[model samples]
Target: MSRTLSVLFILVCYVIQGQSQQVDQDSIKNLRLNILPVVFYTPETGLGYGALGLSTFRLKGEELSTRPSSVQLGITFTSKKQFLMFMPYEFYLDEEKWRFKGELGYYKYFYNFYGVGMDSREEDKELYTADFPRFRLAAYREIFQDFSIGLGYEFDGYHVLEPEPDGLLDTSLDIIGKEGGTISNIGFLALYDTRDNIFHPTKGWYVEGAFYHSARWLGSNYSYQKIELDTRYYQQIKGNVILATNLFLGTRSNGTPFQDLNYLGTKRTRGFDNRRYLDKNEVSLATELRFPLYKRLKGAVFGATGTVIPSLDQTFKASYKGAVGGGLRYIVNKKEGTRLRVDYGISGDGGQFYFTINEAF
Candidate 1:
């Protein structure tokens, strides 16, 4: 896995280096492809390597489409033997009346567990290995202007490959479905979106809500229900400056597995480690200030506060954690506002650097 990722990284560098001299203005079209190499270092995963490719297109050409449909493929491998491969796609059909979006992935993750609640400490790190193949599909049809309703199906199979010795998995918490299980659920989705550009929205709002349930009849190892709400707003403060904000909330019923629970990290808590905190319920509120620097270059400052609790009944306590960071962006595809992002996120635990495509939101 490491060798393959290394080779992929090298190939992407070679291709990008040669792209500038071969640029052709007359060949410009609705189809755009962006590729980049990913490299990061973390204590848990050691040196990680990967590659990501994003393809965006529109049937009616970029001028007529409100937002270009996209497909993303990404993979990563670490010295710890952790592996991940994901392919996600979004499509618009029939003049934007119908929409399809989902993802399929395989993962062998060396996940760290620090118990199951907000009070869990960093010293409680327990390394566990889990292998899984997951997929979800959602299709929506527009019912009103800027509003859509849809249905989705999801399947996740989790197998515990290794459990930490004398660690939280067996000693501290008796988490549901710890031994491995399958979750099969059907969900309902509703979305309201008015973003001018999906890649880099200047002024608009996007809101989504979803409800899902898993039952014995659905081949689920356990029965549970989940609800998620995500809303984002963007405003052009001035020329070449935009303000973006996001609010996200998620909750699940009892008997939910740890994997299904919400965590503060990665996309939500940029400064913290991915999945650093876990619980049945979570809330995150964040904002980013984006502005241009030099030509084809941009910068953003972002900060977020979030927390996870075992139940929705918990008061919005002050135990909330926070992460703040700034990032640099280089416009990879100026026509579509596609960018390559490099960020350094810092929290009380420490800091982590990220490299990838597209905005954090």
Candidate 2:
């Protein structure tokens, strides 16, 4: 039942922008403001949490070069300590509009939870220690004028404080791979956007599809395959209001050795963790009404629903899976109608609040 799509509040992924086919007549030191806030909750893994995050974007010229790059920073807050992260994203484009890009990223999650959110058992008092400094590398290429492809790899091997005598205890809650463990994954990514631009969302369609697998130094002894599909549409309503609708469909293979069921996260769901429940397939739908109130203010209200199954063939079980929620939204950049956002939602168990940039497409 973990297949229910939940949108955790804080940090997540990025959809790369390829090299443009044509140059702009003029360009400038374009600036973009960004923010992301997330929170996690689970009845089985104890009470979970999210990181505190703030971000900004600075790009030199939109017309001077077909390829562009951006810089980002983020932070995470758990039960123990604090964490910081930094990222640099670079991209290239060819005459045929084929886009090539790469990204470097690092994240450190500091905390003191010796044993939390691990499993169904709570009797063991044994504990281990660890600190992780993960390095991530990603590349994206644009193929077929209508389709863009992407790939990413990362290795995280911080440290486990010290293993306890019980033989099965650790300091971190991550079960897929612990602090002493190095988790890595490679992905096949693609996106199709029929809009004026990727950042400035006006009116058009957007679609994203990706497949990912993990290995040893990359992640415990398990390997998993995930297929995700997302689609969105925007329409201008009367009185200058806009209507937005989005759908997400995803599924994971149960063959992964180090992985739990794929819990839907921020991308498709609005109020759940990536591992709350486990299932093979998930489906989500969301619709919103947005109104620009000021030059820097916009408001929105939306509803979302999703469900997960152990497999595509068993997608209709009504057991302990999935979630649903609805909440209000605030927008920045009413002029171009782009920039930042804040959201709040209520699910089957509780409610969640989140903040971020872009239109959530």
Candidate 3:
């Protein structure tokens, strides 16, 4: 459940001092800051509170860059005793020709599991606690106008904090990496991005395809391979109205660990539990219609459908699950078109409220 609710109150004094002033592409600049206090409640994590601060600026004082680079830091604690601290950052250099992006986080939290496949029943739900530190780092070089190729490495170390005695994970003898181990993978990335701004886009397309391989030489506890393709399209339908769509497909092979396999939930299947359905392959599609409601306010209607399969060979044989919802958006940074979003999505199982910064895509 990646839900979050943020209430943003701009520091008016700073805005009046010219922080909101528009500067030409060739002018000197100061960094822009966006900060918000978060408060939200979910059944899984109980009441969570946190703050996120984002700083955006040009690199090497180059104001004509395609987009401003940004660094975001956040921390949160839930009433259920879950704690998380994270930093995500993106940097553009050499006149936006080179890019670096990644995230690092440490978490002590509880997660639920429903056995190992799409057919796993809700009645089989069980909970356990774990502590982990995860990190990913990537660098890309632009090879064309809006296309780039890159390489990235990721590390995830999981340590069981409260083992559930006789639970599925504790009883399953075939599940490798279950007792807590390190997973390290290095991969290649290819991307094509044409969005006017990374935070919000009225018209553009963003596509990425990548593959990663874990090997013994890389100090990984298990060896496996994974591949994914994600594409998103945005278009302005009329005055202040935009339509957005996304398609995502992913699969893993070569003795991939249970935790590393593709799963359906979270960002891809909003109404379901995070990773509620697990398997080696998954496919999902989502669409949303967004339009202005009033000054600084927006409304959206969205729907999504997805499914998980044990293997690529069984792709279409599985049943598809769906979710639909509506949301309200409050423009936080009109200059950059960033917004705070609140959505309520429902599936056959039930509904869940989601709050977050920017669009889900």
Best by lDDT: 1
Worst 10 residues of 1 by lDDT: 1-10
lDDT of each: 0.80, 0.50, 0.78
Rank by TM-score, highest first: 3, 1, 2
Q: What digit string (tens of lDDT, one per residue) describes model 1 on residues 201-287?
A: 999999999999995787899889999999999999999899999999999999898888899876757877767889998988989
TM value for model 1: 0.89
Better model by lDDT: candidate 2 vs candidate 3: 3
Please give the RMSD of candidate 1 to the true structure. 5.0
Candidate 2 per-residue lDDT, tens place, 1-361, comes to 2312243222343323222233332432334434444454433222334433222222333343332333444544444443445454443334314444343444443222222222222233333344556565545555666667677664555444345544543433444444344456677778785654444445778887777777655454556677878888877777767777888777777554222344444545665543333345667687777776765567777776666665666555434333454433443333233355566655554555555545656
Runs in model 3 deviating more than 4 A are 1-29, 42-46
Instruction: Give the Cα-based TM-score of candidate 2 against the true structure.
Output: 0.64
Number of colliding residue pairs in model 1: 0
Q: Which model is ahead, 1 or 2, in terms of TM-score?
A: 1
Question: On residues 77-184, what C-alpha lDDT tens digit does candidate 3 reach at each position?
Answer: 989889998888888877778989999999898777787777888877787788999898888899999999999898888765455799887887877667887889
State each model's C-alpha RMSD to the native. Answer: 5.0, 8.2, 4.5
Per the 3 Å backbone cut-off, how many clashing residue pairs does candidate 3 have? 0
